[model samples]
Target chain A: MSLARLSRSQQSNRLPELLVPAALGTLMLIYFAVPFVAFLTRAGTTNIITGLSTPEAQVAIRNSLLTAPISTLIATAFGVPLAYVLARASFVGKRLVEALVILPLIVPPVVGGAMILTAVGRFTPIGSAAATLGISLTDSLIGVILAQTFVAAPFVIITARAGFGAIDERLEQASRSLGYGPLSTFWNVSLPLARGAIIAGIILTFARAIGEFGATMMVAYNPRTMPTRIWVDFIAGGMDAIVPVALALLGITLAVLTAVQRFGRVPTVIDR
Target chain B: MILELKQLTHRYGDELAVDDVSFELEEGELLALLGPSGCGKTTIVQAIAGHVQPTAGRVVLRNRDVTEASPEDRHVGIVFQQPTLYPHMTVSENVAYGLTARGVEPNQRDERVSEYLELVDLTEQWDAYPSELSGGQQRRVEVARALAPQPDVLLLDEPLSALDRQLRERLRKEIARIQTETGVTTLFVTHDQQEAMALADRLIVMNDGRVSGSGTPRALYGSPPTPFVASFLGRSNTFPATVVAQQPPTLRVGTHKLTVSNQELSVSAGTSVTCHIRPDGLSVIAPGSENGTALSLAGEVVTVTDVGRRYDVTIRTERSDEFVVETVERPPEPGEEITLELPRDRITIFETHDHDRGSTTGVPEH
Candidate 1:
């Protein structure tokens, strides 16, 4: 009658079998935790405040907040619909479309930037058309947005696709039968059901956009975002300038990551 | 009067899921599509509700063709076996989903939602989320939600099949009461024969994507069209019988000469037929007491089982036909000789050609 008997004894008796794996995992956890702790501690009273007060650091922080989230939002607006389609619709070339969407994540980020340049750069056909409309892709805000979206859209698409796929098809059918139309059903039922997954995807996209380095450097080296500025400071000013900014970025990332982990606890459904 | 399906045929790839199933549902009638799995009962309901496309058919509501219409356009309510209540919504909101989707003003929606909650006897749980309610409560909520809009047609796919036996029986009664009060046309589907018989006014027996028969539960049970309905509705002791002597309501089968009505049979004398006698209709009496008037057979009781309210007695007759009888009173002990009196009117005879055509054997031994 006691349901706890099997799992409790199984875990305890199998402790030796799991020892090496557990220790290795714990070791990795500590290895990562140590640096983060040391960084936060060093920035506790001295370097952290000083790092925040720097003028160049302020601009980098401002640009980082502005461009990364904007691109992330753009990606979300575009990516979520595609994710829903991929998860639900059965059309020809779907697998190919999915492969193409996530292809940027696997290719090197610098190469991704270069590919964007060839396609959308001012001198190329699409870029020339844009230039004809007086828009620029090199060393510009638009270039940064493009680069960030290119690098980070895949994260959102992958996660959103999973989230949408995880929902029961019957739920949507029920919604429709209950008199909700196609769009309203999606807004009221489908969207709310997949909320946690959508939030998780947004957080992942945000993180990728914020941490973007190679593509940012390749496309828009000037009008420096935090990552680009960090690269610049690391090369020119060494650890003195780069360390504090890195710590601040780590703190912000940790806060967002914690929020995501706490609120984005979606139950994994096998059928979906 | 409320719902009609005309030549509704649906196909899934190469196989037909629902084959030319046509039936009309009267208002306030709980019509049960009773069959085993993959028998097209669910497909018929889905087609009527506009959830599935019929390859060749027309679904009519109030004499209007709605076969090509969307589910929303059809305005039919549906309840899945698993309660498809919106988990994020409160009970009231869940019940009001159909109305709210149609842009009903908040005040009217709230009143209707409260009315449905009270009708389902879950008024106190209106504020509760779907996850907070028990399985039975959730199913009731699903029922309430489907009924709130006062849709003409209500489709239920084994709504109570997920509950325990006791709860299922209890809820089945509740559904019958609610359907009576609401006066809506309901198409209920279930593999459970008892559930079908208890709830259905008219039972549509389906098998292999086609309708086997459609009539009142008593009509289907008392004088089933084929051997399938005879055994499906209840227990039947089938024996290979030939018409040694034939009359209007009685047939003589070999030397045993068991009495069976020819109303369900379409065969002539000297033709082999399958005779089915209901276990409850068979009575045990002393041999030769029938005095040539009743069809009596001398048999020995092979097995006697106490089936709660009655004793299930299986008698092996000398003609090799095993007669099963159920009686509340004392039954003959095993190996005891007894005469099973088969009344002339209680037996049904079907042509041997239709015997065992759709009756599935090898159901897991209980």
Candidate 2:
């Protein structure tokens, strides 16, 4: 037999041994992907395009695009420092705080929404205080942003913390010895070294924010995002409206997922 | 003139990494802090560089106390054991990192980078990333980076330890040459005694978080104050000697009466002592030769192997004491009875009770 044929036969023999798990994994992928496939197949691209431009759909799209990023930014402002501290510093209750941050990720989105509502709902103590200050959290755009951030911040923290932790402590010490001050060393050495992981974390955080559905539904039903819009179209316009919105949402998420996968690959610096 | 550590004591969670150690560096002199790992050599260098704050001490730079100053404010440059070049930058950019941080004029930064790269003989690798360079080439870039800053003092933390033997030797010589040419007060830390001897004008020997001895490399090697210094600085054959007679400037050793000229010592007669003599100072003689082998001791050659230009011979005496002897001619055959002669003046004497004698008993001066 030719070398190609021999290798192919060899591969074919080994393929059965791997086939069980590989097929199962592919089935798992299909299980999650079939809904998107069906949504796309059931509606034309023009339908999706038109569905996204509808006034209600447009408001949902605008609110999602606007609120998710603001949530991510808010998360970053508090999360980056928190991640650094968790990675580098020793303090009381640090583990507790870290666990608390990851809690939202583990809790169901509806439960997370309920918790937010109980704490900041109009009748609760904090909500009463917020009401005194003329600020509303429940059934508002601000509430949606807060819920997305609450769910999203932990992913950034976990990824950024691991990135910071992976860096050799000696690099910072070396920078300091080379006459760079602590702040300069952090900016020049630590930040650049952790850049890839931080970008990955930001992307992950943004994706989590954009995909947030149940919490947004419960906390801010009035302000509909794409996920909320799809829910509404399913209730109001049946499969005709729902399929197109679902397709649009699926396309946006997939595009974001692909971009994140491309950008989040930690670039190996040649010198290191 | 450049830097000095005064009563430096560095404590890390109650464990003293560096005890009360004090030393000074001249403007252009190369000082090597030589010791095995965990001997507090790095702590001293870090303290002087202002990376570690001594629990109590003064780091005097140009006669000014900079003990509390940060590394940047101290104006000291350091080369870590690993090549810590910025991975994103090329060799030239890595070399210019310090200058760039200092906001040096762009032209000057370029000039300084080129100058240091040339000094390190790495100008050809200027555009190469650190990952693309060989281990030796990367270290050269690290040295170049440290030098480009034009700092008052340079601290090197085992800079050549990562390189292979030939590369380490070559780079060490190159470093000594560069230090001499630049006249930057340099403090280098290394475990290799040969490297310290080859590079430093003065050697600071550390042990267990304390300075054991500090002197010119010649002085420390030639006349080690302590047995640890005598043995650690090089190799020296030490013997158990009794001070049967203590003449004004000399003392006798062993059944064979050998005298060492050490007048300042107040060692009395009949006191037990340890006598050390370097290998080069000892000669293998015929059973009874001229001068009658005055300090001769009988031993059997345990191992004899030719080491290029000379023969590396180990001789074990009746007491199972092994002494390494390097001789130009062929060494005595193994199991052969041999008489080793030690010259009187070259012999070193230490008090038997001296704790440092423990370190030299198993080792002989090279």
Candidate 3:
């Protein structure tokens, strides 16, 4: 009986109703695919080699690789524990905490960078305290790291929170009944269960940090990251200098994203 | 006592989840807390396991006042209704969870894990994850894991409630045998009376967040203390009666007179009460063939239902009361006359009272 229904539903295509939506979907695909195709079509090995030979471009690539990963690591260390807490604990200001964590996702990047500047710029009380500890937050690599961390931390929090929330509470209770304390249970059961989501979050944070523009432009532009360098190159030379560096950044993003998507294929309960 | 609950009163705002409930368990005793939902049976189990702290009283385990202890410190194993096997862990690892938590040597953990898995007859499935097993198989895994630690007490919260009928019946017997072999003081919570009666050494029948009745299966079944007990364990034929005589202990039930044993009737003459007769107490005979030895009711067979091994013949008496007689013999056809003989010794009496859910209808149709 279900087979009959399945075949009937399959037979009824609703082609007339789907035509407009299908056209719109194709239009969107074309819209997204065109620019990337144009960039790739214009580039060659010689241009990439030349772009790589430039000292300023090399420094920018090095700077982005260094700071983006640091931001991602810092985001992970803070966000994962916060996500687990948000998933499991019932605190007085839980909703407020969640809204604050999601602040970077909705607020404009330049605005977030400006807020960070006012709070921890070179002359601010906390900023000088940080400088006294050898950590700078304006026109420096540390400034780039802080801005990227602020903008990208929410990605980790939101994704990891979902992952942690999917786990059954019984699993933790079972661990407790089996004589494990809450901290140990979190390490052994909760962490392993949320491994996939954490990796995915890390990938997204790294990508966002690497490609950061408005915030990095606000906090620090001297020790230029990849995005700032690309902007500089685009202004000085035309699309020629922008092309090769952009492709390099795109390459790194693709590698990490692909690795995350492949490596984070966690065996879900359904796989059991 | 291996376990003791002393005046445990757990409240939720103004409502009582467990109101001054107390009980004691001897070593190796399999006690069942049987009740409908919201009856505090699960609360008592949780309190003993240290998952829930009672608002007022203490839970003593092995003579130790472990009221403020954590679940880890209490060393109690729990098996939930939905078998809570760690899905990521294989069966053997799941069984060895408690031992590993205690930092037991790997060699001993493996041996004990295999032993308990074999105990639940799931040795071959040790390499399988929880979701890979069937409902009954998963339940067996849970039982194995709960037993592996060899805890002082085992708490099962409606463990067999989720299985299909056949699986529940088979696992019921399996759990009883396992409990006997392990000899762990087990306090199992269930809403199913039949399952409770079959598995428990003694049953604690709960109602409204307190113990309403408690006794051995035979004792509670033979002499239910209230209307709830009388019907909960199995079906009972109840009749509203007023005491007519105190000296010889007789009751005027409607127009009929029933002579009950004096000890079963505690109320004075002219006081109203409820008389309970087990369905087995009614013996059907051909009409007008009954002797003067027992109370007789002349009735016509209303329905004859073939219930596998026997037939349930429902007879409607002339007084408009219906009684069901379970018999293996050939039952009379519908509309045929029969005599229902009520044996006086099997009758139980209770003070007239109103049940929250049940009707005041003298006879409840089950």
Q: Ten consecutive residues with minimal summed lDDT in candidate 1 chain B?
A: B357-366
Scored against the true structure, residue A20 in model 2 reaches a CA lDDT of: 80
Candidates by TM-score, descending order: 1, 3, 2
Highest-scoring model, DockQ: 1
Give per-residue CA lDDT, model 1, range A195-228, as digits (tens). 8777777887888898888998888887888898
Going through the candidates in order, state the TM-score of chain A alone for each one.
0.87, 0.82, 0.88
Model 3, residue A198: what's the lDDT?
A: 78
Can you write out model 1's per-residue Cα lDDT over B1-366, one digit (the tens) per residue? 788888989998899888888989887888999988888888787788777888998899978899888888877888988768888899988998888877778889989999888888999998999999998899999999999888888899988888999999989998998988888788899999889988999999887888877899998988877777777788777777776555554456657655444464456677887777788888999776776656788889999999788898889898877877889999889999888887777777777664235542212212
What docking class should model 3 receive?
A: medium
After TM-score superposition, the amount by which residue B243's alpha carbon in candidate 1 deviates from its true location, in angstroms, is 5.0
Candidate 1 backbone collisions, by pair: none
User: Where is model 1 more than 4 Å wrong at Cα?
Assistant: A1-22, A38-55, A255-272, B243-252, B256-265, B268-271, B352-356, B360-366
Q: Which pairs clash inside model 2? A: B235-B364, B235-B365, B235-B366, B236-B364, B236-B365
Stretches of model 3 off by over 4 angstroms after superposition: A1-30, A44-46, A132-134, A260-272, B12-15, B245-249, B262-266, B285-287, B298-302, B315-322, B333-339, B352-366
Residue-level lDDT of model 2, residues B1-366, one tens digit each, is: 788788999898879898888888988989999887888888888888876778998999998899888878877888888768778789998888888777789988888888899998888888888999988888888888888888888899999988889999989988988888898989999999989998888899987777878898888887777787788877777777767665554554445665555434567877777777777677876665637535677878898877678887888876676777779986778888878877676777776455434465445332
Single out the weakest 10-residue window by summed lDDT for candidate 2 chain B.
B357-366
What are the per-residue Cα lDDT tens digits for candidate 2 across A1-272?
37656776788846555568889999999998998677667786446677767798888878888898899898877887788778878788988998898899899998898888877888998888888998888878888998899888898888778778877766777677666888788788887777777777877788889878888877888778888888888888788877666666656766766676566554431211
RMSD of each: 3.8, 4.7, 3.9
Per-residue C-alpha lDDT of model 3 across residues A183-271, encoded as one tens digit per residue? 99888889888788778788878899999998888999879999999999999988887987898899988887776667777433122
